[model samples]
Target: MTKKNLLLTILATSVIAVFAIIALMPFFFLFISSFKAGSEMIRNGLQFKFDFQNYNLANYALIKTERDGIYLKWYLNSIIIMIIQVGAGLFFSSLVGYGLAKYKFRGRNIIFILVLMVMMVPVEILILPLYKEINSFKMIDTYAGVVLPFIVPATGIFFFRQFCSGLPTEIMESGRIDGCSEFGIFFKLMMPIMLPAYGAMTILLAMGSWNSMVWPMIVLRTSEMQTLPIGLQSLLTPYGNNYDLLLSGAVMSVIPIMIIFLLNQKTFIAGMSAGSVKG
Candidate 1:
């Protein structure tokens, strides 16, 4: 490569690295802030002395009517909602994607395009009408009301389809010749091969479900039903900021995701190969 091109590449890499750091700065600050006294965090600069007593779980007590926290309820609610939607999302999408990839059908292109078209539409456009429909069905403020609408995604189908398309047809044909039923072949053989794709899919679905806000906020009316994002929003006072409590809340919201990712790391990396390089 020419010196000019090399210089440009270096410059681009440097700029991207800088931007990545800038984006992550808030999270780094938030983690550290949770460990400091509220007064010291605001009044002093970034470097505050560590004090375990200062960082007591009392910050989380703001949400509790009792000992632990009402935040715990929100956390549980979020987990339940996430479990339902992501499970449904992955299951339905994978079924459809597998069919599309493996079978030849009339109007296949039409259906695929229709699914892709959904990606073009902004979610906000559907909100008002969706809310009205939910209300009409008397589903508002319920767990089903919050999770049902979000239980499917065009992208999940697309990802599964892409991954399945890359799979060799010889395997399927071999399974058929061996007198393997379609369900048996799919579940026993194909599913095992699709682990990497499922891993990536799980990560995407879980993170999105965990962080989902606007729709949940719209559907969940009562404090009892609020999820983590909604609960954190409620923590923001009408008065100025409560730094320690805010930091603690942020940590509570973030730590679970980190732990989940860490625990499932091998699978997550395997999943990252979903639509990419084959084994």
Candidate 2:
């Protein structure tokens, strides 16, 4: 290679590395600040220090929230919602995606187009209508109300459709010849082979559900039904700042996602990359 070309490559790589660090430095700071005391919040803002023992683990202990405001309840709600969303949404999406990719049927193209249109439709637009519907059904202020709206996502279907498009068609045919029913083929073969897809979809759905604020807030008006994201908002009362509790809650919220991503990072990237290449 030419010397100038080599030098440019090194320079470009260094710049990207610097930028990546700059991007991630805040998360590092956030995690560390979670361990800091109220004084640390006042001193250097979010990026200060590493005094790990500033707060004890017991400080964030599960307490029965006065007037049904338990952090543990909210934590459980978020976790349950995450599981339901990730599990059911991924299941239905993958089934639909595989059917679309493999089956030849009437109005197939039109159906695919409809799926795309659904993806294009914004989530905000449905809030008012959904609210009215939930109100009618009396799901308001319940876990079902908190979770049911999230049971569906066009984005998940679109993503799975894209991923499923790249799989070998003959494998599905082979399953059919082996006396497998369509449902059998999906569970026995397609779902298993699509582990990478599942990992990616799980992370995405979980994070979206876990971080959801507006929809959960709307349907779950009662504090008892609050998810972690909405519950954390309560930590900041009107009168004064509660930085320590806020940061602790933030840490608790962030840790689940952080751990999930770290565990599945490689497969997650592979599945995400599959979208463009496979589609």
Candidate 3:
């Protein structure tokens, strides 16, 4: 490469490295603080210095044992909710998106327009009516209540629609010529074709469901049904706070997200790039 090109590349790399450090600083401090005693944390405020004497596994152990291992229960609840939401969201939303993208039926454009409109509206604005609807159905404090409202996300539909729009209709015609059913073509043919899209949506849906707090908090009145976000908030009391358990639990809660990203890194990147260009 020319000298000018080499300099530009080095400059870009340095800028990215600097931003990466800035982005990761908070997480580094969170991990470090999780190891420190509450007193030490209060005194030092996420200092870089590591005092081996002040660090212990007591925080993690306490989290595991606290309230008869309710933290595990909350973690499990979040996992179950994430799985159900991602599965249902992918299946139903993608189907709707595909139909909207490929089929020409009465009111198809109207439905797509409505989906777009819903996407523009903030979730916070709909919370009141949604809570009332859930309450009327007597589904409050149940897992269904938490997972149902988000199962067919507008954002997922829009994403899948854009992705599907770029796919060839010839494949569907080929499947029809082979005497395959519509659902079969979708499940067996299109699903594999849309793996990247699924990967991208999986991360988005999983993260949203896992980190959801306000809606779950509103619907789930019982402590046992609470997800990690709500459960973590409960760690703070008016009398005293469990900073060690709080910070440690927060660190542990991030594990599944990191694992998801690591597993789908390639597909996710491809899906995002393709979707952006196609959309």
Candidate 4:
């Protein structure tokens, strides 16, 4: 290869390597801090050390037994909420998006416009109204309150709509000719076709729902109903701090998201690229 091209290749590789380190630095610190004793962490401030003797599984163990295993309870709550939210969100949001994209119905354009408008409005702004509505239904401090409001996310609807818009209507027409019911066609045919879209949305929605703190903080009044993020924050007390448990719990909290991304990495990338091109 020409020297100019070789130089550019080396430069690009170096830049990427540097940015990768920058991105991973926080995680490295988190892992390292998780291993350090609270006293050592306070003294060293997130530094790497080879003090294996000082590092123990005590923090993790304490987290497990603390307050009747509340950490595990919170983790399970997050997992359950994420599963239900993603399942319901994907089905309802995609169904709405599909109809908006492909069907000719009265008020469809207006509904799509409303979805777009909702997307533009910040969630923080709607929190008050949503909380009031949930309270009116006597759903406060309940899982339903947490999951229901976000089950049909505007962004998910918009994304699926854009993705579905690029899909061929011929498929649907063919299904109709084959005597397939519309719901059957959607579930059997369209869902498989939109797998990549589902993958992308799954990761996004999973991450958001798993890490969601604000809305949950406002809605869930009981400690047992709390998710991981809020549970982690509750580790800190006015009288004393539980840095070791907090740090170790923080490290563990990242595992589910990493697993989700790794599972859907290829499909997620393809979906994102396809969505961008189609959009």
- With a 3 Å backbone cut-off (N, CA, C), the pairs that clash in candidate 4 are none
- Model 4, 1-279: lDDT tens digits are 699999999999999999999999998887866776665667667654466676667777867777788888899989999989988988888999988998989999999999999899888998999999999999999999999888889999999999999887877888899999999889987887788888998899999999999999999899899999998887765335477778889999999989998998787566433322231
Per-residue lDDT of 174 in model 1: 79
lDDT agreement of model 2 with the native: 0.75
Model 1, span 183-202: residue lDDT tens: 88888768877777787787
Q: Write the per-residue lDDT of candidate 2 for residues 83-160, one digit (tens) a residue.
A: 777788887888888788878899888988998898887768999999999899999987677677767667787787
User: By TM-score, who's the top model here?
Assistant: 3
TM-score of each: 0.80, 0.81, 0.89, 0.87
lDDT of 3 at 257: 79
Q: What lDDT is reached at residue 154 by model 2?
A: 72
Q: Which ten residues in a row have the lowest lDDT in candidate 4?
A: 270-279
lDDT for model 3: 0.85
List the RMSD of every prediction in angstroms. 5.1, 4.5, 3.4, 3.5
Per-residue CA lDDT of model 3 for 1-279, tens digit only, reads 699999999999999999999999988888877876655666667766766786777788867787888889899999998889989998898999988888889999999999999999988898999999999989999999998888789999999999899887877888899999988888877877788888898889889999999899899888888999999888765334477678889999999878987888788566433322231
Better model by lDDT: candidate 2 vs candidate 3: 3
lDDT against the true structure, each candidate: 0.78, 0.75, 0.85, 0.85
Residue 102 of candidate 1: its Cα lDDT?
Answer: 85
